[model samples]
Target: MAGILSLVWFVGSVLITPFLMILLCIVFLASIGKSLGVRRLYVKLLLIIFEFGRANIETAQKGSNAEDTSEEDEEHIEEISPLNSNATNDIKHLKTPNGLKKPNNGYVPNGNSVISRDDKLILVPEPPFTMHKTDETTDLSEAKDKCKDYDLCNIFDYLKAGMESIIEDQVTSRFEAEELKNWNLLIRTNRRYEFISWKLTVMWVCGFFVRYFFLFPLRVTICFFGVWWLTLCTALVGYVKEGDFKQKLNKYVSVMCFGILSNAISSVITYHNEENKPKSGICVANHTSPIDVLILMCDNCYSLIGQSHGGFLGILQRALARASPHIWFERSEVRDRHAVANKLKEHVSNPKNPPILIFPEGTCINNTSVMQFKKGSFEVGSVIYPVAIKYDPRFGDAFWNSSKYSMMQYLYMMMTSWAIVCDVWYLPPMQQNEGESAIDFANRVKSVIAKQGGLVDLVWDGQLKRTKPKKEWRERQQEEFSKRLKVE
Candidate 1:
């Protein structure tokens, strides 16, 4: 019994000593915002794996195609009729993927028309109204002239437009996960290429074990450590008197804490235009994931405003509030727009406070587009510092689909992902122009962010992800349709 106890103690010390050393190393390196180039090397290895997977997938596809050459040719011939061939050519001309055509003359729906699409019900306007908007509106007189006769042929264009939308929708897809161009060896992605070859299959199996059994446990430990560190450190800082020293200490602690959290997902962020970083004002960015807060906080400390959450998020929020003034409104308090605005105004008014980060979209987009920006932040009348964050989907999908996944589930996916790679661009500060309405200013800012992030600039509200279209929008569409039906 004595010998067994001795062996057990010896084994335990041997296992724990290295772990403790690693833990200390990570904490020290993360506190100073320095890495040992390990993450970059890991990323390079992932790229090599992806390249191997792509080559294997291509080879498998070529082999299968060679076996079914005659059948493939027949299917191709049947799929591409003269009309569809012309459409395909036009789609190619527009450089659209997945047979999606965004012609110079295609208009996205804006509460104007009701052409429904596939398994899902999405309404769009018929052409020439479908034409893309410009400084000058395209002459719809010819379209009106054809509609004047009220012939069956006139309705065919609507059917055609409806069918096109069904095949390749431009709107609803934005709320869903962004489709990958190539498989990233992750099962969650829409693309699956794991079965392409035996070697590829072996690699995927190994990757699964590595991610789930090895990486997941390590990441969870790091994340929990970060949370505890943040909670305890902020609690201590909360006792400090309100002064420059307290503020500086809080900022340093916050950065280090968030930096540790970032390492949990192996995030590799590339920040641009650091010179434009906001000192003290409203910082607006497109929302893609809750980690947007974590990502931003890692670089610079900011006072965050959001609806109060429970569980893990609640703990962090409470900790942050204790250290600094982060405005976390209860669900009931959120509906009081004026009260919320007042709180924001109060926070921004103080010169000593750090910049307040706000996501004006109000919900997460799929990282493919910038949706409508809520104008409340713009109405604050503060200088707007636009920060554009674009994530590389090849590394990991940073978008949080709140409707599908819970917060914990989303975090699990993020942990198992290869890495969270993103670029953050801090744009020049903007102010609402004299006489410019808040909505217009919001849109202008949204456009700048969309352009900077290489995302589609959309006018649709992201809240439409779960909610129905507004009654006012439906009424506007009806009004426009009634006017179109009447003789002008």
Candidate 2:
């Protein structure tokens, strides 16, 4: 009877255990979904709160600054005005850039000059006026109609205008009307909706942390799924959104897995000389666009060492760094002059992670010519591998082409343009022997890069080649010094 009971119990345990395991898995996945949903909701709330607060603060600050500026302008006007008690009656001609002459004779009660009160001159701050009310229902036509009456009014009319004259003067003096075209270009580049969406998405993902204690396990699951979901969303959204090549590439990678293509292409193109690869050395390349980072990472030529923007982005990069051994430098930390150099030596000395890629051109340029290379990257005693990249005509005007357009604008240009292609040329490794200066090494590498990429004319020699100088600066200076010495 005891043996029969034991057999029954064993059978029950085996049957129940599998059912329990399946139940647990279902619960875990459900909890994860719930956690992610909550986090996203929280993020939206937080963004709304922060945006309202920021807008209020900005508005207040701008108001205060304007008041201060108005007071200062009043003092300046008084100082500049010629001493004639009755000069206010005499029509004083004020010459404007557009050849519009204004009578500056009337002094408002507050002692400010009167001018036309168009929205461009008064209510709106500057070009591409962003001060328009978000609500379309708010009618500004009445205010605009009142503005035209400024021509008929006297001193009292000018004083009634209040900040209008001040706003106009500030806008005219500090902001050029001609710059509106460029400002419009900037607006197009940084598409408002795309930027806002990205920020909100990032925020929503982070909001889950607030409830981590109760939802820790679920949060982890949510994170796993949310990443792929967000990536998909961002990709679809980015593809539709206009931007420059780099911006589009970044958006494509972040939202979808399309970046893998760019990576594969770069890896295939960059010379992979296992035998010639330096055990450890500085890898220097031309800065065409920010996408250049993606190219370097895909090539597996050098470990990235730079500031890490924490959060999901940080986690993704950190995971990649683990495989590639990335060294993260925080922006807040004081830069140790020798620290990076020493680190490079250590990494190169090791069997793993031999090459460190550096963009010696400290900042991004239009890619028409190579900018002056910064000296620090060359200081690492290892051989320098100079890489030069040239974009195809399809991307000529989009990639590292101009500062006038934003990332989105550039991307749009790329989409509309012909097939996007790039040429990557890697020069032979440069070794620094004893007593070699970083400048000399940089110049040597620059020369090699110029020749390989057909960009020699863009370098210093190009200037000398066109419009030959009669004498060098040193020679001219010496000639001047000789004459001075003779006089003495």
TM-scores for every candidate against the unseen true structure: 0.84, 0.40
The 10 consecutive residues of candidate 1 with the worst lDDT sum are: 107-116
Candidate 2: deviation at residue 46, Å? 46
Tens digits of per-residue lDDT for model 1 on 77-148?
Answer: 455434445444433322321212233233222111122333322343543334433435556665465445
Give the Å error, residue 483, model 1.
3.1
Clashing residue pairs for model 1 = 105-131, 106-130, 107-130
Q: Model 2's lDDT to the true fold?
A: 0.45
Give candidate 2 misplaced runs (Cα > 4 Å): 1-280, 310-316, 395-419, 456-488
| Model 1: how far residue 364 lies from native, Å | 1.3
Q: What is the C-alpha lDDT of each candidate?
A: 0.79, 0.45
Candidate 2 structure quality by residue, lDDT tens digits, 1-488: 99999999999787557645533543453323222243235435544644543344334435546665656655645654554433322222121111112332443221123444434322212211123345767566543444333233323323434445453332122111111111111122222212234443354344334233223333333334444443544444444434345333433333223233231121122333334443346678776665676554433435666666676457555544433456777775417757767776776666444366677765554344564566667776666877776554311232443335565455444333222345576667887767878877777787677667755212232222224534674475445334322311
Tell how far residue 261 is off in model 2, in angstroms: 4.8
Best by TM-score: 1
